[model samples]
Target: MDIGAIAAAVMLAVSVRKRLDVFDGPADITTSLMMVGPLLVLGWLVAIALFGGYREDVFGVGTDEYKRVFNASLVTAGMLGIGCYLAKFQLSRGFFLLAFVVGIPLLLMGRLLLRSAIHRARRQGRLQYRVLIAGSPAHVDEVAAVLRREPWLGYHVAGALVPAAHLAEETASGIPIVGTTEHSTALVSTEDADVIFFAGGALSSASQLRTIVWELEKAEVQVVVAPSVTDVSGERIKVRPVGGLPLMHIDPPRATDAARWGKRLFDIVAAAFLIVAFTPLMAYAALRVRLHDGGPVFFNQVRTGRDGEHFGCLKFRTMVVDAEARLAELHAQIGFEAGLFKMKEDPRITPPGRWLRRFSLDELPQLFNVLRGDMSLVGPRPPLPREVAGYESDMMRRLRVRPGMTGLWQVSGRSDLSWSEAVRLDLYYVDNWSMLQDLSILGRTFGAVFGSRGAY
Candidate 1:
């Protein structure tokens, strides 16, 4: 894949230079293709390998592979620039820029497609590594549950190895208890396990764990140790050795003021662009709302914003004027809790309202809220004042960041998510947000809106 990408980039550069007549040297395509192209490809491949792009640990999982690819591309570009300058080659700047611009996305897309294929195969029980879990009974159950929930991670729990005292139990999280932890090596050989996962302080000490790992290594079995912590990004965790003992250092989940300011600037720019681009569609939706009910075209409701402040969140009206008055009856009929109020087929929705809600056209007016500094292009969902009143202390952490027009909850499941699940996602977004993550969420929002998976 890397070689193909490099070749494609070279071809594009050559074609662009020829068409534009930008190069000032002898335009010998055959010589350049045979000489410069091979050198460039070799250098890029070497850079990629040096940056750990081919590491098996990151294969078929997570964003590590993409990050490595990006780092390798940057290194390769830097090397090429220095080489051209030192050698005094008259390479077209436009050609170099265009080649890299085209190449990076092509490489990322190819890897993404490959990952999707691997995930599909894993979901079908193919290409899975058999895992023998060694931990306390509770920890074993916890790890097994997580592995079971995320099958695409490619780990299939073959069984569990608990302490001998707990061998009376038949299973841990539906995985049979095969043997005691003292007999883990024999169990691994007997079960033909490819990996042994130690969850939550499984071994007595670091020395004991190291001994186990050394034994596993001799048998060609991989060992994974899971820390007790959860819901933290790897970027925030650093391993430092103190007195030859490894200690994990965790950073706080707060963004610097500069990052916050940058996010605000991005929100303003994106909201402005979207408002201008979607003006016609917003106008038509407003006209439809006005024509449907002969009532207010815009709906403004008090919602909780950053730091628990109140703001009027704007939206195109998608229900009857008496929708609030009928809320009590509707809630009783549908048996919905006060935390989240959503009905797939509500009687209060007008003909046009249903269509508007289905495609999220009703939320277009929230761009104005974004521009007004009450919301953002990407953040946690804005909650009603009544809903905010019901939040637990931990759940209120979501209010630290500005609300958004579309958020993690909206893209993930929207109205179909349970109240607890929605809160968890919102809190996750609040704690782990980054510029790249915001951009990624915005990109996914378009597909989510078009698919309308859980919009209504």
Candidate 2:
């Protein structure tokens, strides 16, 4: 895949340069293609390899692989730029810029497609690593359950090894306890395990883990240690050696004032652009709502925002007039809980309203809220006043950030999420807010909306 991406990038660069008349003659173009392009491709591949792009640990898992690729591309571009300047190659500036601009997205898209195909294959029980989990009973079960939940990560639990003193009949998580940790090496050999995962606080001592690692060195099995703390971004964690011992230093999640201001500025600019870009669609939707039953075009409701402030959240009306009046009756009929009100198929929805809700067109008017500083482009869900009243102390942490037009909750499961699950996601976003995370969420929102899952 890396070779293919490099070849495609080289071809694209040559084609773009030819179209832009960058070459003085056919010989110049041919020489550049044969010499400059190959060097650039080679440098980029070497950078990617150094960044662990080819490692199996990152192949079918999280955004780490994509992040590395992006970083590698940027480094390659910088080095090539410097090399061109020092060597007086006099490369066309426009052509150089076009190559990277075109190539980066293409590389990322190719990897995304490849990941999807690999995930599909893994789901069909192919191309999976045989994993042997080593931990205490509770830790083993916890790790095994997590691995099972995310099968796309490509870890197939061959078995587990608990403490020798453990008297449990078997792993409560359903992975068989093949042997005790004392005999982990034999267990690995018997199961032909490709990877051995050690859950945090699982082993009896650090020396014991070192022994196990030493024993497995000759066996050529990869050893992984799962930290107890999860869900924290790699950017916030740093490893520093203190007193000859490696210690993990976790940075506070708080953003600097500059970052906060930058996010607000991004929200303003993005909201303005989207509002102008979707004016025609918004106008048509408003007309449909107005002509449906001669009711108001917009719906406004009081919702909680940053710092527990209340604001009027706006949306294109997606229900009949007097929808609020019928809410209680419908809630009673459908058995909706008092905290989060959601009915998959409600009688209150207008004909056009259903389509609007399905595609999230109903939320278009919230750009006004974003522009007015009552919300952000990406943050926690704008909570209802009633929901705010029901919040416990921990749940109220969500009020630390401005409410958003669309958010983690919106993309994850929308109306189908339980109240607790929704609150959990909102808090997670609040504690782990970053520009990259916000961008990732916004990008996924499109797919979620198109998939139309849990959107009602």
Candidate 3:
């Protein structure tokens, strides 16, 4: 709606300029007819709003939000452009170009400003949601801690209802314990909660949870459940309604060749283009690696790719030549796991590596891998073949797709994710593979890389 209105203004400027003829001759009464064009544009603007283009919440966070905005606006513009052509209205090409160029950024900026303002209001407590939590004390405490930390999420922990036999005194986060499990339905209405979170393992019985869900239906409060399983992504869970019951089906992970050919084609073209574009920069990076530390510019190591294949992964050397040798020493000092080692303040990182890692500059050389068909523009994380050797059957699903330079795990919290979370995301990507989805992930990669949320 905002975009259409803005575009209408642009069209009006065109009509006014073309019809006025003020630079050459005096304006005539027929010039007043130009107002009719703007009136029609206003009608189009209302139509666009009625088509669901004006709603903001669907575009709240992540790429889906921006996708909805862009897709809807483009559809509306395309239809309007067609209508003008069919009606034999000779609109200025400049008018259409100007409107498109100006309107998209304007609408995007408007949404950004609105989101910021709403977040600010939520932080100030002017906008808040009263919520009831249902679960064991531990789960209740975990949920409560997150809410307390980020008040802008808008949840106000009103109270809790524990299972009757647990005998837990109160939530560790200090929300009052209001009722026993038996009176869960009554307690929600009394507290007038906007949302109810069924927290943790204590809600072991689905029949009981369903009964509570049935009661909440009458109260008209939103219900969210925290599953007992940890580190599960929602994409992997499918709720199928069979007969009268909703059965949760967990889909096994697999990447098929149905879209694989198209994806491979896309990666080939995009990677080929990027490698050419960044050749000079790559050359400079190679120089820097040699100058900073007199060693090899490109570090090649064996990494696992699709279907357990080993490929030489290329990265700009971001550490000392002896970094591999020093790993055991550092692990001994830090006492990390034999298989998975992390040195928070590793001394092996070169000065350039630290800066390179910070902004993801070190990964640029992987364009060669992408072009060589050993990697993809987007897919699962490339694990060491050693890491793949230890994979559970479920973890092996990540190898179905070609390893990517940037992927779901890359953009989604990066190293901050637990190993289980990373595997879940990788599997989810393989199961739900789409070229459009890959494009969306690639767009988000910029923000993730630049934001540096979990780089090292």
Candidate of highest TM-score:
1
Over 1-456, each residue of candidate 2 has an lDDT whose tens digit, in order, gives 777877787677767776775446442466655667778888989999998888877876778899899999999999999998999886766557777888888888999999889888887888899998888877888788778756777889988888778745587767888888888888899989999999854587788888988999899899988777655667778989888777998877642321378899999999999999999999999999999999999999899988888999999999988999998898788777767888877889999999999999999999999999999988888988888898999888888888888788988779888887788788778777788788988998998999888987
lDDT of each: 0.83, 0.83, 0.74
Task: List model 1 lDDT by residue over 1-456, tens digit each.
Answer: 878887898898778766765646555455545666778788888988899999999877768899999889888888888988999976667667777888888788888889989988998999999999888888888888778757888899988888777785556357788888888788899999999998864677778887777777779999888777766666678999999888999888753431388999998998899999999999899899999869999999999998999999998898899999999998888787768888887889988898899899999999999888999888888999889898889988888888888888988778888887788788877777777778878888887888998977
Q: Which residue runs of candidate 1 sit more than 4 Å off their true CA positions?
A: 23-26, 88-95, 120-126, 168-175, 255-259
Candidate closer to the true structure by lDDT (higher is better), 2 or 3: 2
What is the total number of backbone clashes in candidate 2?
0
Error of 3 at 97 (Å): 5.7
TM-score of 1: 0.91
Candidate 3 residue-wise lDDT, 1-456, digit = tens: 464547555655555656644354432323433643564456545654665556644544444455555666677578767877898765555555555566667666677777667777888997788988887777878778767756767788988878887656577767788887678778888998888888775575779888888877877788887655443334557888899777777655337851367888888899889888988978887888899969998889899998889999999999999988887788678776633344455688888888778788888889889888899989888899778778889888788779999998888778777776677778778876766678879988998999998887
List the candidates ranked by lDDT, beginning with the highest: 2, 1, 3
Worst 10 residues of 3 by lDDT: 24-33
| lDDT, candidate 1, at 443 | 84
